[model samples]
Target: MVEAVFQILRAGKSLELIMSSYELLNEIEKRFPRIYVSESSGNGSPELVVIEEAWLPFMVSLDVMSSEKETNRRKLRGLFDPNGFHELITGLAEMAYKTNSQRLDTKVCVFIPLSLTLQPASKTTLLQFLGNMLLFQYLVNVLEGDFLARISMYKESMNWNFLRECLINMLLASKRVNYRVLMKECLHTICGLYQDYAGIRNEPDSSDEHSSENHNTDVAIALLEVQRTTCMAMQKLIIMIMEIDMSKQQANMLGLTTRSDGLRIPLIEIILDELTYYRKILPRFLQIFNDPKWKLEIIVQYLLKYTAKPVRTRRSNGPSEDSTFLGVLKSFSDSSSAYMSLTSQQQLPGMPGCNEAVIDSLSLVEISKNVAAAFNSLREADKKIQISSLGKEALFTATMIISTS
Candidate 1:
């Protein structure tokens, strides 16, 4: 039956053929199902379940893939048909339940294509492939409970390929499919990949199958797209994290924001590391900045964050925190050309303006105010005036201008 399904799928080219194949499979399963009813000692006719587990994976895959051309193969325009994927996964899950198997089998795994149809040989596809494998591992194994929903986005790593394909498809689509939700799904996947890979390496000294350049430049680029996509998703998640009222659980998911509730914030460390990478690929980032309204404010927000809660280097004559605040600040200050380009560019289409207003509205000004508060808190404790000044003169000048205005 499975072989028949596969043969028919390969032969068919149109929507009708695909529909027919699925109908055939449904009919076959109803009649045979590779089982039998046997009479027993009790209760009328005892139903003896003869479960045919052999080549189960192949059969299940055939049942799904045969019904939909887009399900198993990549489309021409470099986007994926997500409905195809939906059918495939749904078929696998249904088959697993019917067969009473605890987990999906390798045969089901074997049908997963080597290359998806979208954007042949592009770097985007490479990352999507990696995202899919890692996401599958997490979904089928780790975080299989309530914690799973917390990381519901973990499933997205697999779908990045699909979303990329979908994006391409929409561009050529006769009628476009809104990909905002799809983009968000892909970004979630990318974040998950970053969390996984970043989690695996605890120290800078660790070695792996891929070179650091490959991981950072190649793999990281893919994840970065996910980050970029999130920005495209209208910064919905980003805005949520920035909200002062954000709950502890929500803060954890928005990995780049500062978390006051935790003993330590993981997101800040992640941003620091990401910024370090950005510094390495400064030229590339400069290029992205040139593309459009890349939301320089989000980048600026991240840069300014370290100024407030600078990472304290763990001493051991060991790993030094290295005052990354200065590093980030310097990067921003150094990018005079990029900033000028940004200021002059026509505010690239997708991103809305007024981000400048948002940045001005943030706590950047409060840093100096905090200094006064800190000074007052310490003045009485020590019974001595602790005098330290650096940016104070600049702040004073700025205050004067503000007061006059």
Candidate 2:
């Protein structure tokens, strides 16, 4: 069914085929099916009824549908509803987390191929949903370059929250949707920007291709400055999923712990790959997030847990053959031993006792261990060409404690 629709859309014909598919799925089935669940009290299980078959292809078609019609700026303006696309993106990771509550132990990410056809959308909301998800494709690509503040209208429409919401969803769903292709492109772009930053920021012997790529020093600086902050905040957002797992004790306050067994391995891999690959710029950029206002401990803990194991990229056909960041990720992942040797962790004064304390204490130790490992990785990785050279000085005081120990 999808193949036929894709062919029609690909041919640049009218959206007749796609619309017919939507209407067919939209039709209600007459037969009522029953489902049952056993009650814990030993009473008879309750039977549940669903109105529609919830054809998933209908939902997947929305992406292509919107892309076909979203040529005008005004067409997408109506998507900014109070309880709509914004929340969908920001809350998707958490939702995926809960939906697979029983399966997190297996390292299965709750994020799945979204089936939007099941949503109870009014005609108004349906259009909004289509336009919004399509817009996500452009926004993710935009962040890869210096397009943020270039246009006055873009400045008015997009803010930190907006970007954060979309990117978070994109990261989780990149393996499933149109987001995958574009995000891979965005990663490539960000990697190049990091390369330019590296060559220009360092003294001679840094490759000419790097510094020469962005001949305008001021533009390169501007791009990295914004890119760093965005990436740090994005990292914090990704780390929060793991933090949500660790904070299962406070499910009521955060309203995010319905299923907190743990983060899935795939999600962890995605986060680790980005964080590891961008270690070139992240350590310096991370200072913005280190302000006491944010939860730096969780960020540190996330790094330790995911990067603890070496990144093993399976050989594949296309771009995987020579990605610059893949080598760095593998190197960082292999340094787990250097990270595990920290013997003691400093206790924070006046800390509360409870689940919060457990998470924080674990966080402190993880933070301590990662800091120590980086310094060690640096001293050694300098001799080896693969380790990132960005963050050695970022953890000066923390590394000192390990050295003295």
Candidate 3:
């Protein structure tokens, strides 16, 4: 029966045949109906034999019905055919949900290959559903389950491209969903993988020279390229989100409430944290900053914006809150002492301009004035800022904490 169904499917039979096959399978129980069962030939009457029919359901699942291949092909001519690939996904999802199963059975998953589907389009329910389904958390769940072992088989079989593509998909999904924590974890994993590859290359007495070199150089380069691109993508996303956050603040300044999580962690603060994370390897990030395509100047503009006076919340109760931005300014001034100490005779790329940028961007004197003004302006709502005013004393003792390196 399975052979017959396969023959029909290969032959490209009619739609009616396919529908009938599907309906018939739906009516059948788990056990297959045997056609003929024969025993010893001499004495017993001919017995009907029945075999378990895997193909009936499988073919039906494929939605192939007819023996006439041409008719079926004609019936399924268009991409929008009623029994299109999407319906298969819909059916699979439904079955999986009904069965209380998260893992698609191997046979069922094979029947509906993920590669055959299209990514859902923007602003659509399907897109949202697909995005949620393929989020980093979801992939992490898959990784922690049986899928990890199966994924290893693909890698072991030298299917690195597919694995890489899958990883890329996971990264993109993370960005689309704004799953920051998960995205960071994935980035860390990629970095760890690169470091491990490098360590293997640096190992002593390794015989597989070509493999070690390839792993350390080629694989590491590819990984770094992806990581850089992903980081830039995240930066751009954050910038756009920051713009929205800025607009909200402007509105709020005019007495409107803006509900945004962007305020929870400013983009500049995040970048600063990222930079600090690898401060010991400053050369790497500095190299990245020097890259021609990164638009470091534009990034510098945003960083300057973050240096603006920190506005005191209406709920603040002390001087400390009022001087928050001043404290930051003090820190900046302290750092800039290295620049101040250097003579005009010193020449370096971007260094000469740094002093002017800092002065024009947000002068130390102006920041100090803002701190004083903030305190005078403070009402009961800004008591925190008032309390933080003692931070102003740090300015008088400013000095650079320079490293000889």
Each candidate: what lDDT? 0.33, 0.33, 0.33
lDDT of 1 by residue, 296-343 (tens): 434543433333222344564652222232233432333342243223
User: Which stretches in model 1 have alpha-carbon errors above 4 Å?
Assistant: 1-169, 172-178, 203-405
RMSD, one per candidate, in order? 22.6, 20.9, 25.7
- Best of the two (1, 2) by lDDT: 2
Measured on C-alpha atoms, candidate 1 has an lDDT of 0.33
Error of 1 at 50 (Å): 60
Candidate 3 lDDT over 232-331, as tens digits, reads: 3333333333333344344456544433212334333444445446544233334333333233433343233333333467887654421233343342
lDDT of 3: 0.33
In model 2, which regions exceed 4 Å deviation? Answer: 1-176, 198-268, 273-356, 362-405
Report the number of the highest-lDDT candidate: 2
Give per-residue CA lDDT, model 2, range 1-405, as digits (tens): 433433332232223333343333223111211111223355543322222443211122222334435534322333222123334444322222222111111221111113432432232322232222223322223222212222222234322322222223324333233333333333333343334334333433324555454333322233334434333434444344333323333333444323322223433334335655656635533533354423343344333443323234565444221121222223343444334323213222221112333344454445555555556664553454343444545466566665666
What TM-score do all the candidates reach, one by one?
A: 0.22, 0.29, 0.25
TM-score: the better of candidates 1 and 3:
3
Error of 3 at 15 (Å): 35
